[model samples]
Each structure stands twice: as C-alpha cells, then as structure tokens.
Target: MLAKAIFLDIGGIVLEINWRKTVEALGVFDRSQQDQIWSVLGSAKIHLELERGNATPQEFFAFVRSELKLSPEAPLEEAWNQLILGPLPQVDQIFDRYAGRVPLYALSNTNRPHYDYFMKQFPVMKRFDRILTSFELGHRKPDSEIYMAAATEVGLSPSEIVFIDDSPANVDAAGRLGFRSFHSVNSVSATLEILQRHFSN
Candidate 1:
C-alpha cells in the first residue's frame, strides 16, 4: 500500500483548461489561427518564461501580436481567461477529505501569468499541502529533478507516494522513479477511487 503522499496535476486534473473551446469563444480567430497561436504559446521557452513569473499577460499578448502579425485589437487576456472555463467544484472536497489524512501536493508545468490568474480567481486552489510549479522550480515534468525535489520537500520515500498528472510522459517518468502514478483522465471520479483504495490502508 502507498503510505505517504498524494500529488495532483492542476491543469486538467483539478482545473479544466480547454484551449480550443476558449479560442472559439473568443471569436476573433479561426481554428487554424488558434492552432498556430497554441503552437507558439506552448513552446518550451514561452512556457518556461511564464512559469518563472518573467512574463505578464500583456507581455505575452504583445509577443503573440508581433509573432502572428496581428493588430492590437485581439482580446488576449480575456481569451486566456476563457481557458479556465470550468472550475472543478469537487476538487476542494477531495483535498479536504485527504489533506491531513495523507500528504497532498499539487504539481504543474504552468507559467507565471496563469498561476497568478488562477490564484486570484480561485481561493480554494491554494489549499494543497505543497504547491510546485515548473516555472518556479526551473524544471518541468518528465524531468527527474522536479519529481525528486517534490519527494524531498515532502520528506517521503518515492515508493510511499502516488503522483497524478494529465500527461502520459509525466506519469511514465514518475512511475520509473518508483512513484505509483495515475494518468488523470476522468479525473475526479478516477482519482478519488485511487485515493480511497490507497489511503484505506
């Protein structure tokens, strides 16, 4: 049985960020342009900069405008906000049930602006026992260092913990490092089941 900790991935696991839905709602750009925009936005450099708190929404907007050759009329911030379209209401309840009963953590490969935006928008989001962001860590998922750091910070053997993430690569990485891991599809229901089974010990 897993004895020590539980870690969650914030993006799709706790909060749903549907970039495609958001861009469509923004209505200024078509699917093709949105795809291009995501290509640039999801680049390692840009994402790392965001995680480090080195970039602001306005700054990202400016960068996108310049790169896409678009005019200043785009609603970048608003469109970005659209990504967090639906907040998972049951998220806190799950944490509440298990936080002190077992160690709980949040690990994400998110940039600064989105991190700030999430905190400001969702007070309940900050309830994790430990919060690890890639930008802040200077290391993102699928990298062993970040996982090592998380386990170290929590003071547990990697074998005693389980890591949950929306990415297969991340799940596999954690698995290789001896963490029990789950790919966070159908997150709340599936995760709660895993936690219940593990923590029942």
Candidate 2:
C-alpha cells in the first residue's frame, strides 16, 4: 500500500549507540563489570520507566550511582549522554529521497537527556515533520498505546502509515496494529529501499 506518512526510529535507525561506551565513560573497564552495569542500566523496567517519563533524569542518575556504587562525583549525566554515538551512515538519503513526498515522523523510545543531546547534535532531526518520543508521550514501543497514539496524532489509520524501526518487536507491534512496518536492522539503505519500493510512486 502507498503510505500516507512515515514513522522512523531514531536510536539504531538514524543514530548509532554504544552502551559499552557509556559504561567505559563511567569508568568501568572490567569486562564483567561492564556487562553487569549495562545489564542494570538497560533493564526493561529501568529503561521503560525512564523512557515512559515516569522517572526524572535526576532520579535515574541517582539510582545508577547508588546501585553501581559509583563515586559521589561521578559524571553520570555526561557518561549517560555518551550512549548516542552519532547519526548512521547515509541517513540523509532517506530524507533526500522521501522528504516532502509524505510526512516523515521520528518515533523513538528515548529519555529527555538523550533526546535533547541528539536533537542538538544532529541537524538531520530537523527534517522530520514531527517527532514522537516515548518520554514525551508516556508510552514506549512494542506497546499498542504508543502506535495508536501516533496514528491518531498523524490523523491516519495504522494502515496508511509506514513505520520503520530497528527493533523486531517494535516492527511486529506496528504490523500487528495494521501499520505497514519495516525492520530497518540498523541499515539506512535498506530502509530507503523499502520506502522507495512501497511509497515511491
């Protein structure tokens, strides 16, 4: 089906993130310690709470410091911000090819700090017609509520929108909701091809 609009994911699709980098930045060099730290930081509950706007960034940092036994002066915020490496390669091609053809929206599960950091650092973000973040909406991906809310906000049925995300679960969730969804798998070129194939006309 021809898409009336497009929803793209940010973290893996538009940007590259390294959880290990954040761990290292936090001064954790031991492999096992890094794994354990990342596991805690990346847990579904903690991530969901933060991205769902249920917890403030200050609360998150404080929890991390306390749980990880970090020094009182540890640069928690700075290191956490390091999770976003930068934009992916050739991401511009997606906008270059599809912008103005249809509404392009960014749908991401991100907290305030990372959202602010990426928005400031990446000029490409300005290309989206709108941005829908979990933190802003109080819902995260793989949940029907967020996708339904997004569809409602865009004034379209799920079937009319093309949703692209790197997470298989998110793609499946959108598809189950009747969205024309694609799993980008961290490849901008593949996402572009899918858009071109379905929406190029």
Candidate 3:
C-alpha cells in the first residue's frame, strides 16, 4: 500500500552511534566494567526516565557519575554524547528523494542533550517535516502511546503510515498497531530499499 506518511528513527538508522565510545570516553578502563557500564547506560529504568523527560540531564549525569564512580568532574555530557558518532552514509538521499513526495517525520527515543547536540551538528535533521521525540512527547518507542501520538500528529491512521526503525521490537510494536513497518537494521541503503518498494511510484 502507498504510504501517506513515513516515520523514521534517528539514531542507528539515520545516524550511527557507538555506546562503547561513550563508555571509553567516560574513562572506564577495566574490561570487566565495560558490560557493567553498558548496563548502567542502557538501563531502561535509568535511561528511560531521561528519554521520557522525567529526569533532567543533570540528574541523569549525576546518577551516572555516582553509579559508575567516575570523577566528580568527569566530562559527562561530552562523554555521553560520544555515542552519537555522525549521520549514516547516503542518508540525505532518502530525504532528497522523499522530502516533498510524502510527509517525513523523525520519531526518536532521545534525551534533551542528545537532541540539542544532533540538531546543531547535523544539517540533515532539518530536512524532516517534523520531529517527534521521546523527551518532547513523554513517551518512547515500543510503547503504543508514541505511535498513536505520531498518527494523531500527522492525522493518519496507522495503516496509512510507513514506520522505519532499526529495532525489531519497535518495528513489531508498530506492526502490531497496524502500521506498515519496516526494520531497517541501521542501514540507510536498507531503508532506501524499503522506501523504494513502497514509496516509489
């Protein structure tokens, strides 16, 4: 079916990220502590609060410093943002091809700091018709509310919107909600391939 709108995930799909970069930047020298650092950084309980806007970046950074036992003056913000390396290769092609063809929305599960950093650093981000973020929406992906909210914002039914995300769980959630969902597996080429099959005339 032809899509009236498309919702795309930012990190991992439109942009490349490396969590280990953040961990190393934070000075976690022990290999044994890397997994622990990953768990702490990725912990849904801790990170989700930031994504949902329930916790301020300062609060989150303080918690990370305490949890990870980093120096009090650790460059937490810079280190945390190390996860966002840069945009995916050829991502602008997707926007170039589809910007005016159909509505393109960025649906991202992100916090305020990351949002601010990417917005300024990535010019491609300006290409989106709209950006729906977890921090702004108070909801994250794999949750039905955010998807429903996206549909409401665009005034489209789930079936009429094509959703693209790297996470299988998020794709499954969107699919369950009746969206025409595609798992792009963090590849711009894969995303372009999927969009061409559906969005190309």
Candidate 4:
C-alpha cells in the first residue's frame, strides 16, 4: 500500500529529549526537592493534564513554583524546555528526502511552550505541511479523537497514512484505528524498512 501522508512524533523520533533534564536543570539540588518535583509535576494527573492542553505554560510554571517552592531565579522556558536537546541526523535526512514527495506532518503530544521552543530552535521542522499538537488540538496521542482528527487533517483514511512513534501504546492505538503504524524506538533502519515497505524508497 502506498501512503499518501506521513505522521511523525516529535519528541523521540525527530529530536532527542532527556525527560529528567527538566528536574535536573531546575535545580534538583537535593533529594527532597527532587521528590517534590516528581510528586507534583510528574504526577499522572497534573502531567497528563499539562500534556492534554488543560494548563497553559504560565499555569504549569505557577504550579511548579508554588508547590515545589522554586525560586524565581531561572527562566520558566528553561525549566520546561530542558528536555529538548537536538535533532536526529538520520531523521533529518529522512524528512528532507520525503518532505515534498509526501505530505509530511507532525502529530505530537506536547504543550504550547514546548511547541514554540521546538519550532524556534529547529527551523527545519517548518517543512512539515501541518503540525497537530496536543496543546493546539486539546487531545493527546492514543486517543480516538486525535487519531480521527489526524486522518481528517491528512484527508485520508487511516490505512492511507503511516504513523510513526516511539511509544508502543501510541503505535497500538494507531493500529487499532487501521493506521499503518510503526514503533520507532529500536532502530532507524527498521523504521526506514517499514516506510519502504509502504512507499517508494
């Protein structure tokens, strides 16, 4: 089957992210401070809400400051954007090769601040025809609504598009919806093989 569009996840697929980098940079100087950070911000309820676009960046920052007793020394962007590292070289080549040939889009679970920082820091991401983020769409990956919206955004049935993500849950979610999804955590060559199987190499 030929894929008319491609949906890619940003965090682990296109760029490198160290999730713990946030707590570390935000000055987790002690065990108690670390515990406080994880207990509150890392909590499923709070963190999921943040990813699902319920809380704005400022709101999350305020919650962190108030709950974690963080000083006002560091910039809020730094704390939140700490996870973002750099681009994946092979992924960049993949995008450059298939960008205009196929309609490439980003379907990521991320908040507003993270989205803005990524676009600004990695201008190459602008090549995507569209970027559907959780913050903008008010839904996260593995959700039926988001998957449907992605199909709509690409103007194709789920089977007509290919979704690549590092999360197994997300891959399974896409597969359930009949999307030609692939798990991308283990190897880039493997992902390339999946794409080649569905599209002209």
* lDDT of each candidate versus the true structure: 0.77, 0.88, 0.88, 0.80
Model 2 clash pairs?
none
RMSD of each: 2.5, 1.3, 1.3, 2.2
- Per-structure clash totals for the candidates: 4, 0, 0, 0
Q: Flag regions of model 2 displaced more than 4 Å.
A: none
lDDT of 2: 0.88
lDDT by residue (1-201, candidate 1, tens digit) is 546888889887889888786567556467788897677767736555666556655676777668666668876666666787555757776777886788778988877667778888887677777788887776788889888887887888788988888899999999999999888763687778877877863
Cα-based lDDT at residue 195, candidate 3: 88
lDDT value, residue 69 of candidate 1: 66
- Candidate 2 TM-score, true structure as reference: 0.96
**Which residue pairs clash within candidate 3?**
none
- Residue lDDT tens for model 3, 94-195: 998999989999999999999999999999999999999998888999899999988998899999998999899999999999999989866888898888
lDDT of 4 by residue, 101-163 (tens): 888888999888888888999977888899988776778888888989878866899989899
TM-score of each: 0.85, 0.96, 0.95, 0.90
User: Candidate 1, overall lDDT?
Assistant: 0.77
Local error of candidate 1 at 56, Å? Answer: 6.5
Q: State the displacement of the C-alpha of residue 193, model 3, in Å, after optimal TM-score superposition.
A: 1.1
User: How do the residues 1-201 of candidate 2 rate in per-residue lDDT, one tens digit apiece?
Assistant: 556899999988888988888999977799998998778779847667999999988888888888888898998888988888888999898888888888999999989999888889999999999999999888999889999998898899999998899999999999999999889877887888888877754
